[model samples]
Target: MSLIQACVTAATTLLAVLIGGWLTVRTQDRLWRRDQERQWRDIRLNAYTDFIGAVREYVAFILNPAARITVVPRPRDPGDLMPFFDDVGSRYRERLESTKTALRLVAGRPEVVSVSAELVRQARLLAAARADSGVEALQADRFDALWEAERRFIETARADLGLPSAFVS
Candidate 1:
């Protein structure tokens, strides 16, 4: 081929290589972002589930009549009951707190964090009741408060994850 034709071919090849590289990089970057998002969603889901589970477990324990009776020697007696209450409360709180790390890592929305904090607060109240007055003192109002807090947390988490408001479970 002539020198001019050779120069034209080289220029065309160089342009094609540049365009191909750019497209490849763009596609790879998009895929990488998508993967990161999916991973974060999974982490958030696990954290929410764990936190809810911990709260529910604590509530159930306190609400059970047997647990209340066993924990409290008598309604008026305040001797030696606190140690048992403390042990149960600390164990469940630690489980819940462990999941908070994962939650803070992936929770981007403020509502999700706030609702989760409500769950923690409600759990603490239940723990305090168990500590001070025993399970007999865990009234319906307390359970209702915790239940409402849990529902709000679930709704906020679903919204943050792009799920429909009507989404159940």
Candidate 2:
């Protein structure tokens, strides 16, 4: 080939290589970002599930009459019940706090974090009320409020993770 043709061929090849490299890098970057997003969603979902589970367990323990008796046998004096409440409440609170912290760290939206916080707050309130009085102290209003908080948290978390709502219109 002539000198000009050789230089033209070299330039064309160089251009093709540059374009190919750029495209490859762009595609790889996109894939990496997609993978990272999927991983984050998984983490957030796990955190949300864990937090919800902790709250449910805590509520169940507090509400179940058998659970209370199993934790600490009833004493002749009603005042002696404080120790039982303290023990069960503290253990459940620790689990809830740990899961809440994890949810906050991985939550994609502020709403999810706020709702989770509200749920935790409601759980704490219910625990306190039950501890101070007795299981009978768990009023319907407080129970409803706790359920509402949980519903909001679940909704927010579902939205954050791109999942459909549990309820239908």
Candidate 3:
């Protein structure tokens, strides 16, 4: 073949190879994105469940200071439950922080962020109820208010977490 004909053949081969490489890379990227989405769903499920556990613990803490709380090797009940109370409080705090980290890694969807924040608010309100101590009826009313807030905040969390309403009870 002539020199010009040889160069034209080589150019055609290069174009075909480039197109094939592009197609392979595109297919690989699509599969990888699907796998990452599945992993995200799993992380969300774990984080949501942890949030539920922490909220319920706080509600119990607020409803009755004298109620028993248990840990390995011992169970504790006291008017002040100070040491045990502090431990439980810390546990909830840590769970909340980890959930936040997971959300950030997932790009922090607004639904998840709002619901999680509401649950945290409920926990804090219940903690405040435990601190309310006085003979007055108005002081007693704080417990009632705290209980209402518990239901309100947790409902939002449940919906965002994709949990059924039946699970709320």
Poorly placed runs, candidate 3 (over 4 Å): 1-13, 64-107, 133-169
lDDT of 3 by residue, 1-169 (tens): 9999999999999999999999999999999998877686677666666656656665555455453333222133323222224664666556656765665455325666665665555455445434444223225455555456546545654555455674435
Candidate 2 lDDT over residue span 84-149, tens digit each:
345655687678779989988889999998998788767766765676567876689989999999
Clashing pairs in 1: none
Q: lDDT order of candidates, best first?
A: 2, 1, 3
Best by lDDT: 2
lDDT of 1: 0.72
lDDT for each candidate structure: 0.72, 0.80, 0.56
lDDT of 1 by residue, 1-169 (tens): 8999999999999999999999999999999999999988888888778877877776666665555322334345232232244455557556777776667767869888888877876766665566556566667887789888888998889888888885445
Between prediction 1 and prediction 2, the one with superior TM-score is 2
- Candidate 2 structure, TM-score to reference: 0.84
TM-score for each candidate, following the candidate numbering: 0.77, 0.84, 0.54
* 1 or 3, greater by TM-score: 1
User: TM-score of model 1 relative to the true fold?
Assistant: 0.77
